[model samples]
Target: MLTPLFERRIDRMNRGIAEGSLTARLPSGETRVLGGRAAGPAAVIELRSWRAMLRLALDGSSGWYAAWLAGEWASPDPVQLFALFTGNRAALAVEARAMGPSLLAKRVWHWLRRNHRSGSRRNIRFHYDLGNDFYEAWLDSRMNYSSAIFRGAESLEDAQAAKLRAMLERTATAPGDKILEIGCGWGPFVELAAREGRSVHGITLSTEQKAYAETRLSGHAGARFSLTDYRDVTGTYDAVASIEMAEAVGRRYWPDYLAAIARALKPGGHAALQFITYDDAMFEAYAANVDFIQRHVFPGGLLISESAFRALAAENGLLWQDQVNFGASYAETLRQWRERFDAAADADRLPAQFDAKFVDLWRYYLMYCEGGFRGGSIDVVQITLVKD
Candidate 1:
């Protein structure tokens, strides 16, 4: 039965939908249409139980995810719903954010998972150590886990190669220049550098990544992989390339991350970095509460604030340059990945260790991120920071 309090809560959420429309079917066979003020993506949600709304009201995205896990709600196309919420996030404000004890508890738990030296390794392992074979089942041939830059109708593999080339070009390394790749996954960038006759060294906190990278480049005399923390790196390189790794560094360690880059680069050397960023306007609120990604997908992860990150780089004697935003490409990349993942899952190619629930969670994670990029609130960027 639908209670008056739950109905009122649903009404409040509807009022905040400044853009897009949602048609929600309640358990009592009632349908409510919300937010037709403007033309936008329309999504339909079926509420199996009113507790789903209550969960969303109290726990925000994380709670809503829990409700989904419990079969309290269903959506024909969740991507539309996610995009709608993210696109109208500013107008929705606190309506979709955690509150009360849930907020406080999640914040404390997130603090505990901060990316300190040891915690960094643990956190990396939590996501990346799912085994190389597991990722290989779904990822591209190059095993590029980050966003790929698509040009026209090229394949995902070609797009990923283009992204790698783009990042390397930003570094402008000569044939003999030594290149350091921070958070190198599966040796794609390092192998490319080594093939170009550059002395390439790749570092990662994930044991699985380091092992896979080293094995992948075993025949290349100029390529090496190390399990090392960025803060502890102890050498100057002609160029540095860190692809989509900065998000793993928590907000408290932004300075440390920039300082490490500054210390590792030779004078006038360039550091090409690919990082995810939150819209400047929404960063504070996003940081204040634990979102679905932070709570379940990537522990200790926080998206960058471009202004603050650039300021930190400047403070560390690194001049920011050639910033490129390719968030739409990321959305497409994620969509492709999800398609591949679903194919692999249907074929039973995924590892036996990851059960059905884990698979569903992974699917949701990819969808959530894809929608985030599509909505324009979150973005992925490639930028060069030159050492002064």
Candidate 2:
């Protein structure tokens, strides 16, 4: 139905291709290579309809994703598929000249996403409650839902362990220290802290996550988890830590979230947080787009921009005295996950309840995120917030 728009966008993109910017191979066997030979990532993307392409071209990130989920298009390699889009940024710029969601629509959506406690719980459950067995097919042994820190090229398992050790080291727990962890996923941090003789109190809103963490840490004498909201934690602690959880707090609640951390920490306490961070430009651009991740992956989540974080941290008196970045590792993490997931699906080992649509949805999620980190569109930071 939107063939006219699709044709027009491709025509504009063709101009950029003429400048040696990109290459494309359509399913119809037509090749478009602007200033150079028609070499591909040499892959074919089967666009099932111009309607899908129109949605992609106009609806921003969420557009293509919804189409893909609806079986409107597919590629042999999802990772390479995203690389094609991300790699051909110039061509997309040409195409997007006057095509995007309206500001009024964005404002309406932003206003709708309030991220209250119940909504946060629903969002967490929506993603994490997909079942542990589903995750076990792809994730490392510990099942960290965030980026794994890699030292050079390494196995995902080793990289995940390395990441855990980094967080545990940064916490620098002492015997009998009362450490509170917000947004603890599956309780790896709690187990590690318990092993160090620290009494670890961890909270998460996901009921499945809470059950899994409790079972996983059952043998650890000092580990406990509560289905508690972050805003309700009143106990002071020797240390507080959260990994990749702050982003779900919503930008509007950044100050209150930071204040919660500040309140949870004892005087002179340390807080270590791992954040999937965005720079100013990337954050602004992303905030303006139809985020497929927010709609489909983490419903109530929003990215943490370094600028917003700094401002809120300053306002809340939470200062990052130490920091490290290992964002490049996330690409590899997603790569291994996608590989494992594909292998498992090929083996038909995924849950019988999972259909092809679910498979495609997850594939897009992993590959899409991989593109973000690989292209430096986003970064991950480990910051030690000091309560000064």
Candidate 3:
């Protein structure tokens, strides 16, 4: 009952395919030719197996293809499956190279200003901002919306709760303290903090999320949501925190993002930001994974090198207080999300394509990220900072 909107959108996406710029790998480990219809909008590409097509459609790789095929996975987009098989991975690679660290930072900054506004942010809203009801089916009750922490939990709900509690504890916040949550998702932190008698102010880019948070916090006088970019926030707070939203801020804006937080915090105020980052020194092993995320998942996102973070923090007058690594926790969290998504799909609350695509993408995303962490290719770092 989704009407023709999803189908129409799929059609439009296929039309972009007809323009013949798209390319994807086949199960045979070779790229295939996609033929446009002589008179229609759809293009056809043949694969040897439905499993192959599904992998191409879902995971784009055969390694974990069966995981999604057996009805065991989920993610935000189904088209990523199509993207893997029929979209242009080579082009994505080229673009990823264009964003390499060796490239001048100023040049990267200029490119970000030009392309940052409409890339991943639009894609995120197109897929994620549909409604909280859609996400509620799969996510934990807290609706944290960022990656869950999977430490010492036997179940998904328990793990996500741990993640939330960890956030609250790490900040070491007190009741009635003023806190700023950058890129607040659904206001879980605001709700949690407010419940603890803290005055919480949250800023986010998603209007749908802001609206949902407002409703979620309707009775909490200590919590407030604002539809403002981080750069525009001007005030003093006891603490500052951001969860998983720094990727979209882009490396070009990292300094600015840190600067804004530093400015917004009172002198000696503590800040904690948790994010997924690539170990650029290990580029060969993990760079491809990062490229995939940029192309199909978070288009304009950037993963900062730890050294880059240190230098940026120092430059912005932020004293590095402490840093914690939670990569294994994130991997466990993704696994839980995939399971929940599959369950939701089985119950018929989630669309088939959505479930399949997410499973495939998430398997790759999670495993790759997990491998990065284990192999030191990437890290999920919670860096505590203080204004000097």
In terms of TM-score, the best-performing candidate is: 1
Off by over 4 Å in 2: 1-8, 14-21, 27-29, 34-48, 70-73, 84-113
Residue-pair clashes, model 1: 0
**Clash pairs of candidate 1?**
none
Cα error, candidate 3, residue 236 (Å):
1.0
In terms of TM-score, which candidate is stronger, 1 or 2?
1
lDDT of 3 by residue, 1-388 (tens): 4324433433444444432322333334455444343322122332333343223333323323343445433323333333332232222222223333433342353354322445435645754576777678778887866666665747776776666677777666799799999989888878888899989999887778889889878999899999777888988999998988777777667888888988998988888788877655543433333344554455566677777778898998889866788776775676566667667767887644465566456546644444334433456877788888
Q: In model 3, where do residues sit more than 4 Å from their true spots?
A: 1-124, 283-290, 351-376
> Native-vs-model 3 lDDT?
0.62
Give per-residue CA lDDT, model 2, range 191-221, as digits (tens). 8788889999999988888988898889999
The predicted structure with the larger lDDT, 2 or 3, is 2
Q: How close is candidate 3 to the true structure, as a TM-score?
A: 0.68
Clashing pairs in 2: 17-34
lDDT of 1 by residue, 119-227 (tens): 8988899999999999999999989999999977889999999999999899989898999888998889998889988999899988898888888789986899888
Each prediction's TM-score versus the true structure:
0.97, 0.88, 0.68
